[model samples]
Target: MKSPVRVMLIIILIILVVAGGTVATAMYLKHHRHQAATAATATHQLSAKEAAALQVSLPQMTTNLQTSGLIQFTVTLQADKKATKNELTLMQSQIEDSINQIMRQYTPDQLRNDKGLNSLKQTILKSVNHMLPTGSVTNIYFSQVLVQ
Candidate 1:
């Protein structure tokens, strides 16, 4: 016959093993779910038709930099939805003015690299989103960027 102490020890060991497994499984599932969500976001891409429907393209703009030189670029703003696009269209002049003001803050050398251009785009995106009563700007694309 088994001793009482031995039986109790075995029961405790079994409980510990089961509890550990349950905790591990819960953690593993949570980690994988988070990874899957991140992967889906990273892989998602908008089709051309979808992009066009949500985008507002501004005409070519020419402005002088902070101190010297001239910069010319065609900006395309991507809105979060159709209503935002329509709002952006209606407020095109204000958007242009904001872009012009932002451009003046940078020098020709500031917008010469991808880093600078990306910074400019982020700044524009933030500014435009602030102007809108609803919805928001998701991105900014510069089709043509010339600094001379």
Candidate 2:
């Protein structure tokens, strides 16, 4: 009787430990995932009206790549606010120069793939945001990307 009682208590203890660990792990994951999702959405999720109001579209650009080949693209920049959009328009020449400089750093082959294109966009976003004084750029969109 005594042995049986001890065995039962030990089994219960083990079960409780396992259950507690599982619950803790699940809660940890849930909390972290929620935070991550919120952060990602904060940066990317925007209403259509907000996006349209804050967007600045650059004229088509034609430039030579680093190694060889010509590239042409039209970029639309999404600013954080109307003021930022206005600033972007005012600084269009500087932005174009920045884009041209960045474009010259990549080859046609680099811009051909999705990974490369995404990398380019990220680089441009970071560069543009860094240069902004009043407000930042939220996102970048390439309306047209043609690499030859």
Candidate 3:
């Protein structure tokens, strides 16, 4: 029993409401997409030059094997970047001296342990760093270790 004009008005109002909602959703989606793009751009990260400067080289080593006293075990040691090229040339002798002093105390049995070897590597890094002018040997690598 509603009037025809009233029914038409109600339908027009409903259409207007639905259209408003669609416009608001499209605006929100556009804004959120832009925000997401900016966040991705902000996350582009880089490291400092000093942090990247440390270079590691793997050097092989030979150790006397436990059995028969004649066999040898070989290992590779990774060396970190020294303060300078001169430090690398001269530091090896002093670092070798320090390592020899510490290693002489450990028997073949102690060296057999994986954790012990890692600790030993750290120890060598520490000792070598102390002798460098810059006071840091970033790391050590063991590429090919042979124990005989």
Best by lDDT: 1
* Candidate 3, poorest ten consecutive residues by summed lDDT: 69-78
Ranking of predictions according to TM-score: 1, 2, 3
Q: Over the stretch 1-148, how does candidate 2's per-residue lDDT look in tens digits?
A: 8999999999999999999999999999999999999999677767898789889999999999999799999999999888899899999999999999999999988999999999999999999998888899978999899999
Q: Rate the local accuracy (lDDT) of all candidates.
A: 0.94, 0.93, 0.59
lDDT (Cα, 0-100) at 54 in candidate 1: 96
| lDDT digits (tens) for residues 1-148 of candidate 1 | 5699899999999999999999999999999999999999858888989988899999999999998999999999998788999999999999999999999999988899988998999999999999999999989999999999
Could you tell me the lDDT of residue 117 within candidate 2? 97
Model 1 spans > 4 angstroms off: 1-44
List candidate 3 stretches off by more than 4 Å. Answer: 1-82
lDDT of 3 at 38: 93
Model 2 spans with C-alpha error above 4 angstroms: 1-44
TM-score of 1: 0.71
lDDT of 3: 0.59
